[model samples]
Target: MPAAALKNKPLPTQSTAKRSVLFDSPYAPMAKHRLPAGRPREWYVTHNRRLKAMRLAIALLDSGVYLANQAHDETIRSTAEEIGVHPPSNTTCHMVRALMRYSR
Candidate 1:
């Protein structure tokens, strides 16, 4: 516990340390997390909408669609399909454009 004892301790070797799969492969698929139960139905709806919007926004950005006006509802929906997600609702499309607008 003393400073002298700490200074005498040898650094941990790789064999002694725990390794994370994420560290070995940064792009590895992550485990899905279960959402807590007992929340209102509206809460889940909004949560999923936000996630869909975020994914669409990122896809648009990656595809070189920078401006909110440039990202039409059809475009966002098509991107969602391309990314293997169901087509988003109009409200989700609006949220995606808002995300793009505010990201600037």
Candidate 2:
């Protein structure tokens, strides 16, 4: 296909585009917002708290699982229970599969 004949994807769904701020076209002026100086939102704090707890759970895996690089298993059970976040699916297959992939 020729570059001139290519088509762009439609605008993403809200949940997908909400996190992006960059504009792709010269004709599209960026949306401007004036945030009041100082102070962050309560929801941001709660989000950070969950992220911290998730990182702690990943660190706990170091003793038993030998996952390569920064490949953290997103599904953590015990730490999730302790922190009162969503519980992982009650399965051990994820770790075994991760190990099998790394060995090859």
lDDT of each: 0.70, 0.39
Clashing pairs in 1: none
Clashes of each: 0, 0
Q: Best by TM-score, which number?
A: 1
lDDT (Cα) of model 1: 0.70
> What TM-score does model 2 achieve against the real structure?
0.24
Per-prediction RMSD in angstroms? Answer: 14.6, 17.5
Give the Cα error of residue 84 in candidate 2, in Å: 5.8
Can you tell me which runs of candidate 1 are displaced by over 4 Å?
Answer: 1-31
| Candidate 1 C-alpha error for residue 54, in Å | 0.3
lDDT of 2 by residue, 6-61 (tens): 86634422322112222232222225565454657865654445444444334334
Supply candidate 1's per-residue lDDT for 12: 23
CA-RMSD of model 1:
14.6
